[model samples]
Target: MISSTTMGLLVLLALSIPVGIVLFLLGFGIDAFFSPFPLIRGLGNLVWSTSNNATLIAIPFFVLLGEVLVRSGVAARTYAALDRWVSWLPGGLVHANVATATMFSATSGSSVATAATVATVAMPQAERLGYDPKLFSGAIAAGGTLGIMIPPSINLIVYGFLTQSSIPKLFLAGLLPGLGLALGFMVIVAIICLLRPDLGGERRMFPFVQMMRALLALVPIILLFTVIIGSIYKGWATPTEAASVGVFGALLIGAVFGTMNLSVLHESLLGTIKITSMIMLVVIGASFLNFTLASANLGGALEGLLDSMNLTPFGLILVVVGIYIVLGFFIETLSLMVVTIPIIVPLVVAQGYDPIWFGILMIVLIEMALITPPVGLNLYVVQGARKTGRMGDVMLGVIPFVLVMLGMVALLIAFPQIALYLPETID
Candidate 1:
């Protein structure tokens, strides 16, 4: 059955079908070929349950927040500000890409939105400056993955909602690791540029007064992050409610910045609808497929496989990590999490591993998945932003970051506290 599903996915995806459609086709195949039950009957229920979710409502809200920021000129200002601060680094504006993405990650919940925001504002600069498209675009795609790792992340909220973990704790657990990955990305860029000077743009230093002025440009994003995350930790609102707070905060900031107008708002709303609808289609399809897969004894097969291994706790973790990396290559990040977490998380917890730690671990793997080939959403996003470059450049650019992610995985394995320390101390 597993073999059959794998072949089906390959054949359908090779035909260049849309990922959401491919998932539906695979679900139907699973129901008809592998399962004994009439799993297709559950499709309507799964679609309704997935879309009607209050928690999932955060998806649209976060995407809208990013849209407002980008359409309002805030994202461009923030990118320019970061460029002033980090352009002196060895990698020049590429460092700014990582920095801006990190900042936006604090405010926005969606990685695609973060990538789109950064790419929209930064891509023009890459062309103007004669920077390598691979690293420039790769930085945006890889850095945008921070959206899921930072506090107030929609992906973490979704993981919590699905796994029955505390959202606040998940948020806390992500803080340190998120920052660490940003730093790691910078370090890798520096090393790469240091080895081959031609890969990066010339490092430029800004005056002290100009740098201070740039600092002021960050105020709007800082305030928005505080409002959204503070509301959650202060018990003033649930994660969903905080998303509403974020939307209002974005609008107010845009208006105050004098970038808000009827046309801007309309475009923002339309962009939000298009992205939200795209994501929801995949999400809804994934949920229905999950229902059918679960009913078809896929979970039982996974359990039997794990049980047969009879490995130690650490060994079991490595297996899980391996599983996510392999699956990550083929599945969308959210769908990958939805389809596997039900079967995998329970097994990891049974091995005496911390759920929060595992969640962060899974996120790092998922972040890698975002950049990996064949089905990586980030790859497609970065490619879409480019007018002429081949997709392979973006894929090649992410290779170093993928290595960084591997090291991060090993670090988390060596010291579980990397993920658990902040959450444990906070509450």
Candidate 2:
């Protein structure tokens, strides 16, 4: 059953079928071939159950908030402002790409949104400044992965929903690791540029006064992040409520910055509808697929396979990491999470691992997947923004960042405190 299901998934995905449709097809296949029970009858309840949730409501709110911010021109200003602070580094404007993506990730929630916003703003600068296209574009693609690792993350929300864990706790757990990944990206870029100076564009230092002024542009973003994350930490709002607050805060910031107008609002709303619809469709389809898989005892089979290996906890973790890395190559990140969490989380928990820590670890892998080849959404996003570069340039550029992500995975496995510390402190 597992073998057949995997083959079906790869074939359908390779055929350019929508991920949601592929999931539905897989669910029907399982129901017909593997499940003795009539799992098809529960499709209505599964769809309703998946869609009717306050937690899931946070997804659209956060997405709209990102859309509003993107359309309002703040993102471009923020990118320029960040360039002033970080462009003096060995990698010049490349550092700014990572920095700006990290900043936006705090609020954008969606990795694709974060990547698109940063790529749109930063790509023009890469061309104008004669920066190396591979490293320059690669930085934006890798840095954008922070969106799902930072607070107010749509992926983290989905992880929490599917795992029945606390969304706020997951948010807290992700904070340090996400920031660490951003810092690691810069460090790696600096080291690489230091070795190959030509790859880095001209490093320019700003006057003290101008650098100070750039701080003003960043204030609104920082305050907006503070308001959303602060509310959740203070126990004043659920993740959903914090997301709505973020939307209002984004609009207010836009208005104050004189960037808000009806046109921007209309674009934000339309973009929100398109993105949210896509997410919900994939989510609902995954829910049905998970239901059918459960009915077919697929989870049990996987557990038995793992248990039969007689692996130690550390060995089990390595196996899980390997699984995600391989699957990450082909699966859309969210769909991967929804389909595997039910089966994987329980197995990891049985091995005495914390689900929250595993979630963070999983996110790091997902982040790597975002920059990985062929199907990596962020690579395509960055490449599309370039409008001229060979796709291979973006793919080759992300190689170093992918290695850094692997290092992050090892760190998390060896010392889970990297993920648990922040969450443990808050409560």
Candidate 3:
């Protein structure tokens, strides 16, 4: 069953099957070939159970919030505002790309959205300013991964809903590590650009007064993040409720900027429906597949296999990380989580790891996947934003940030508190 499932999955994916469809097909395969009972009969119940989840409602709300911000011109303004402060760093505008991505990630809850936003704003500047395309583009891609690691993250909501963990706690767990990763991105970029100054654009320090004025442009996003996360942390709202608050806040911000219109709202709703449907399909398919796996006792078989190996805890984590890195090469990030978390997370939890910490760890791996080659979504997004650069330049650019992510993985392993501190200390 294991061999067939793994092999069939790869074959289906290679044939260009949609990931959600591939999961459903795999589930049917498992039931037909492996299960003695008719597992297909249980499909209706499984779909209903997955679709009826109230916690899952956060997905659309967060996706809508990102859409509103993107459509209302908030992201471009935030990027330009941040450039004034961070462009004076060794990496110049490259630091702005990272800083803007980090800030936008806090508001957006989507790595793809954040990457796309920054790439659109920063790519033209890179060309006009004579910046090396690789690092400048790479910084936006890598920095954008913070969207899943920060509070109000759509991915964390999905993780919590699937794992039956606390979404608020997962949000808290990701805070320190998310900021740390952002800082690490900036430091790494600065070091590289300091050594090869030509790679960064011209370092221009804005006057303090002008920088302060640029600060005003960031208030909308900052307040939106605060409203979303603060309500949750203060025990006044659930994550889903906070997402609604965010949508309202986004609308108000749009009005303040005088960009709110029927068209933007229409676009936001349509985008929300499209993204939400895609996510829900994968989620529902994973649910059915998981149900079949449970019926077939794959968990017990997996445990037995692990016991036969007699692997230590750390060794097991290394194996899990290795699995994510390998899988990251081909699978989409959301699909990857929905497909594996049901199986892999349970195994990790059974080994005495905290589910919240592991969620953050998984997110780091997801972030790495976003910037890794072959199927790295951010690489393509950044490259598409550029009218002239070779795709290889974007690929080559992400190498250092990938190294920084590897270091982050090791740091999390060495000092798990980086992800755990806020969650444990707060509520």
Candidate 4:
């Protein structure tokens, strides 16, 4: 049954069917052929219960927060400001791309939004400055993935919801590793540019006073991140409520920056609706599929199969990581998470791994998925923002950063405390 299900998923996806539809079809197939009891009768209730969560409200709110920053031109200013601060590095403005994405990721929960926001603002600079499109665009694509691993992350929220884990703890768990990954990206860029000076564009250092002044442009985003994350950590608000606060803060900041108007708000709303609808559809479909899979006892079969392997707990985790890497190349990040969380999380937990730590580790892998080939959403997003460039450039550019991500995965496995320290310290 597992082998057949895997084959069906690949076949449907290869046929170019939408991921949401594929999940629904898989659920119906399992109900008809695999389950002893009827699963179709409960579909409506399952979807309602899945979508009715208040925590999920954070999705649209965070999307709007990113949209507001992008439409109001604040994102551009922030990118330029970071350019003043980090362009002196070996990779020049590419460092700014990664820095801007890291800053934006603190507030923007969606990796796609983070990537789009950075690409929209930074692509023009790359063309004008004569930077290699491959490395510059690759930095944006790879850096934007920090969105999921950073706090106020939509992916972490979804993982928490599906696993019944504490969302705030998950957020805390992701913080250290996320920031570490961003720093790792910057270091890799520096090393590469140092080795091949031509790949890096001109390195320009702003005056010290000017660099200090550029810090002002970053204030709004930092404050917004602090408010959203602080509220949750301080026990003053839930994640959903904090997301509402983030939207209001973003709007107020937009107004203070003299960029807020009805047009911006209107566009932000439309973007939010489009993104939120897409996410909810995938979530709803996955919920039904998970219900059907559980009814079919797919979890039992998977667990029994693993138990028969007689592997160490660490070996089991390595296998899980391998599964995600392989599945990630074909599946969209959200679809991948929603589909596998039910089956995989329980098995890992049974081996005595912490879910919060595992959640952070999963996100690191998902970050790689965002930049990987064919199905990597971030790669396409960065490529689309380019006025002239082959998609292959973006693909080739991400190779080094993907290796950085793999090292991050190994670090997380070898030293679980990287993800756990913040949460444990706070508790």
Q: Tell me the spans in candidate 1 whose CA falls farther than 4 Å from its real position.
A: 33-37
Taking the tens digit of each residue's C-alpha lDDT, what string does model 2 give over 1-427? 7888888998999999999999999999999999899888989988998999889999999999999999999899999889889989999999999999999999899899999999999888888899999999999999999999999899999999999998999999999999999999999999999999999989999998999999999999999999999999999998899999999999998999898999999999999999999999999999999999998999999988988999999999999999989998998888888888988999999989999999999999988888886689999999889999699999999999999999999999889999999889877
C-alpha lDDT of residue 81 in model 1: 95
TM-score of each: 0.93, 0.99, 0.98, 0.99
TM-score of 3: 0.98
Clashes of each: 0, 0, 0, 0
Model 3: how far residue 136 lies from native, Å: 0.9
lDDT of 3 by residue, 1-427 (tens): 6667778888898899988999999999889987899999988888998899899988898999999999999988998899999888898999999888888888789898889888998888988899988898889899888888987798998899889999999999998888889999999998998899888879998889999999999988888888888899988999989998999999999999999899999999999899889889999998888888888888778778887999898888999999999989988898789878878888898889999999999999999999887878888988889978699998899999999899999999999988888888775
Task: Name the lDDT value of residue 202 in candidate 3.
Answer: 94
Question: Model 3: runs farther than 4 Å from truth?
Answer: none
- Cα lDDT listed for each candidate: 0.86, 0.93, 0.89, 0.92
Which scores higher on lDDT, 2 or 3? 2
Determine which window of 10 residues in candidate 3 has minimal summed lDDT. Answer: 1-10
Pairs clashing within candidate 2:
none
- Encode model 1's per-residue lDDT on 67-186: one tens digit a residue: 888889888899999999999989899999999999999988778888888888888888888788888888999999999999878779778877889888898888889999999999
Worst 10 residues of 2 by lDDT: 366-375
The total of clashing pairs for model 3 equals 0
Ranked by lDDT, the better of candidates 1 and 4 is 4
